[model samples]
Target: MTLKVTDLCIARGGIPVLTGVNFTLAPGAALILRGPNGSGKTTLLRTLAGLQPPLGGRIEAPPESLVYAGHADGIKQVLSVAENLTFWARVFGRRDIDAALAAFELAPLADRAAGTLSAGQKRRLGLARLLVTGRPVWLLDEPTVSLDAHATALFAAAVRAHLAEGGSALIATHIDLGLAEAAALDVAPLRARAPAPDDFDGVFA
Candidate 1:
């Protein structure tokens, strides 16, 4: 599936943060989003993922084709690693999790309680869920937060594999995944202007 965003505007806390945004993520391609800390990268990703509505403009893609991974690992601390993957797979209507475990090298930790794992291990586990989601588009925010160089390479490999199979990714990260299919976009220039004196963003339609 291809995702197209045209003249997109996104906001945070009811205040416009990014405007005039545009991009297309073709099948088998990845787009790396770059901007300063306060930039609207997260907002943009959230908007694209349909977690929040865009303030204006368009985002076109097949329905239910996107999955998002944010800064938090989004794991179940009480569950075993394998159980967690199984849980997500079932939720997404998938039944097998073997590929997810092997992709992130989480098989060794499969029976371990997620809470007992180190930060990097938790991160790997969190990313492993992507494999089971079965969605064609991935929206990742700071995906490599707790990973070491080796683990980062593992993630890059997984992404390459996903792309090789026609998946698309929109990643918001500082680390270079070294993907040849990567394209970079800087969103600083699109930061929104101060709200107008008469602007009624929260109160009006």
Candidate 2:
């Protein structure tokens, strides 16, 4: 599957944060979204994930064909790592959670509550949940935020494998993710343009 964004403009609280953004992600490819704070990296990712609606552009993709892993881990504080995966698996109508947990080296911590896990560990768990979905497109916002070298390597490997399998990804991160063919898109220029007085209301509303 492919992700196509046409003249996408994203807004927050009725103010334009990203404007006139355009890009396409073909299958087996990746895009690295970069920009300073308030430059709309996260906003762009959110828009692509369908978590945030576009103000005046269009995002064309199947509803259930994409997975979004945002800055928040999206974990349940009261649930164990395995429990969290179990819940999500059921939500997505899946049965097997072991393989995904194993892939992320989270099997040993399966029984531990997410609240007890370290930051990096929690991030890994969040990522593992995304893997379980087996979705064709991934919108990851700072996916490697708290991961260490080893975990980062694992995440990169997982991404490589995902692309090898003909999946597409749009990653918003400041760090290089070791994606060999991933194209980088800088959003600063778009954000630099002055916002119209009604830009926010027009775009985000």
Candidate 3:
């Protein structure tokens, strides 16, 4: 199914941050979000992932079609690497996690506790959860944070494989994940204008 967003508007803390956003993500494709820091990329992804309600506009997709991977890693530190994937897989009604483990080269550390992994390893484990989700649309926020070059390539390959299998991804990141087939969307132009300075703006200060 294609993921569609029409005239979308997003907000942070009840204040508009991105407006007039529009895009379509067809199956087997990836859309990379481009923007400088504080340009509402994270907020937009959060809204799209249903972490928060949209301020306006429409998102057209099947229910439970989207899966999100954010900066928090979302893994239980006490669980082993394999266990973490298994736990998420079960939540998504999946039981097979071998492919996910190998996708991130996490098999060797499968038995190690998530808390024992390094920063890069943890990030990879966090990302691997996407596979277990079995969701068609992926909303990723800064997916490569703390990843080294090899790990990034692993992630890029995993994304390519996902696209090949008719899955779509919306990623917010500044780095190239080596996905030449992925299209880019710059959110800077869609950024909501700064609110006009008001005399009472600093009243609370």
Supply the TM-score for candidate 3. Answer: 0.95
Worst 10 residues of 1 by lDDT: 196-205
Supply the TM-score for candidate 2. Answer: 0.92
* Ten contiguous residues minimizing lDDT sum, candidate 3: 196-205
TM-scores, all candidates, are 0.95, 0.92, 0.95
Candidate 2 per-residue lDDT, tens place, 1-205, comes to 9888888888776677777888999999999988887788887887777776777788888978899998889999999999999999888888799877877899999999999999999999999987778798999988999999999998998899889999999998888887879999999988835556767644335
Each prediction's RMSD over C-alphas, in Å, is 1.7, 2.1, 2.7
Give candidate 3 regions above 4 Å deviation.
198-205
Computed on alpha carbons, the lDDT of every model, listed in order, comes to 0.92, 0.87, 0.92
Candidate ranking (lDDT, best to worst): 3, 1, 2
Better by TM-score, candidate 3 or 2 = 3
